[model samples]
Target: MDVAVEVEDLWFTYPGSTEPTLRGINLRIERGSFTIIAGPSGCGKTTLCRCFNGLIPHFYGGTLRGRVLVNGIDVASRSTHELAREVGMVFQEPEDQLICLSVEREIAFGPENLGLPTEEVKSRVEEALKALRIEHLRDKAPFELSGGEQQKVAIAAALALKPSVLVLDEPTSNLDPVSALELTKALIELNEEGLTVILVEHRLDLVARYADQVVLMDRGAVLVQGDPREALSSEEALRLGVAVPKPIRLFKQLLVHGVKLARPPLTSEELAEGLVEFLGRHRG
Candidate 1:
């Protein structure tokens, strides 16, 4: 299978914590697919994403067991710098990652560090800027950009590495609705262009429609993993406080009233179509 990332029987614990934060995680992310890792707070979502890029045992100094492979290479055997060639990571807070004075410099940092020729670095910086639609913010200082803009800059910085996989952790937590939607559109555009996207987020409403799969976690273990319709529609997911999308919830209610949709809808548009079809057939 054309897998981008693979985790096997994974377990991990922090340096001082008495308990493991991730437990027996086994997952496979296919290349060029958009996947969402979601659950309630403290469900090990961040910890699991960390494993993909060697942050767990390497940077975090935690006890890690089992195996994590990115692009068929053992993450544990490779340094984080080496893993960066295949996986690009963006944290929850953009401020935590932004260190350059200007947005242009921030995006160029990764390629420049790789010791690429100056012209190559410049070319990558320009491409990254264009990809995220942040070309206008290039010359502006990182501090001057809004929260959404700063987040885009951070993503652009990661993209400059030309990684095959992009991992984002709660990237929309600090943005307003409009900004969040704008960011979501940009990400979808990138995913359509063949970059594998693995996102850790709670806002299912914004991303579920585009996700090829959803993995729901609970208390350091996977609660459900499958199609968005199947995963989000599970009673267990709602009970575990996974933010099942509004459309799924509405369809579930209709199901309770003896109305079954041929296919559960994940987005508002799909839900509307289902509703219209039901109304058309049952108009007494």
Candidate 2:
């Protein structure tokens, strides 16, 4: 497989803390795949993501062991600035990443800080704005935009660097349902264009069906990881409060009552199809 990010026996501990936050994590995320990293709170999901862009031991000052590679480069070997060219990170809170006054400036900030030529920076800014389809908001200030708009601006800023990978941590936590769905669709569109997306989120109902792979982490380690159907349906994941999508959960209960789907369904649409097929067969 063409791997975008690889973690081998990774371990990390925060400064002034005794217990490690991440423990013996081994994972491989394929190129151009939409992968979701999910689990209960404090399962080290965010910390593990930090390792993807050289933020763990580099910026957070922690004890890091094992190896983490992004786009075939060792994360510990490069500065965050260096990796920013290869991996763009969007945090849980869009406001935390937004500092510029205007939307265009927010998108341009990264390339400008990278010291790209004037025309190159401007070109990148325009490309990012167009990519996110936010050209109409170019003149507005970030503080004036909605939560979803700010998140889009943050993503656009990250894209301005022209990175091959995008890692987001619970990006929809603050948005309304409509905005969250819109953001999710935007990310899906980006992934369809071959950008490797690693989304750290708990809203399985919103994204589980769209992921190529689902990784369930718990207590600072990966408890289950594989195809979404298998990973999210794992008894271990469900027992650990991984928040399996409602459709999947409902079907599991149906199976216990002697109603089995040809396969597990990840979304409501799939669940409905399964039932329809089952009913037709019975009537026939």
Best by the lDDT measure: 2
CA lDDT, candidate 1, residue 228: 92
Q: List the residue pairs that clash in candidate 2.
A: none
Q: Give Cα distance to truth, residue 224, candidate 2, Å.
A: 0.8
The window of 10 residues in a row where model 2 has the poorest summed lDDT is 275-284
> Cα deviation in Å at residue 36, candidate 2?
0.5
Error of 2 at 132 (Å): 1.1
Candidate 2, residues 1-284, lDDT tens digits: the string is 89999999999999999999999999999999999999889989999989999987789998999999998999999999999999999998988889989998888889999999999999999988888899999999999999999999999999999999999999999999999999999999999999999999888899999999999888899988899998888898778888788988988999999888877899888999999888887784
Question: Mind giving the per-residue lDDT tens digits that candidate 1 earns over 21-108?
Answer: 9999899899999999998888899989889999878999989999999999999999999899899999889898999999999998
Predictions: Cα RMSD each: 1.3, 1.3
Q: What number of backbone clashes does candidate 2 have, counting pairs of residues 3 or more apart or in separate chains? A: 0
Least well predicted 10-residue stretch by lDDT in candidate 1:
260-269
TM-score of each: 0.97, 0.97
Cα lDDT of all candidates, in order? Answer: 0.92, 0.92
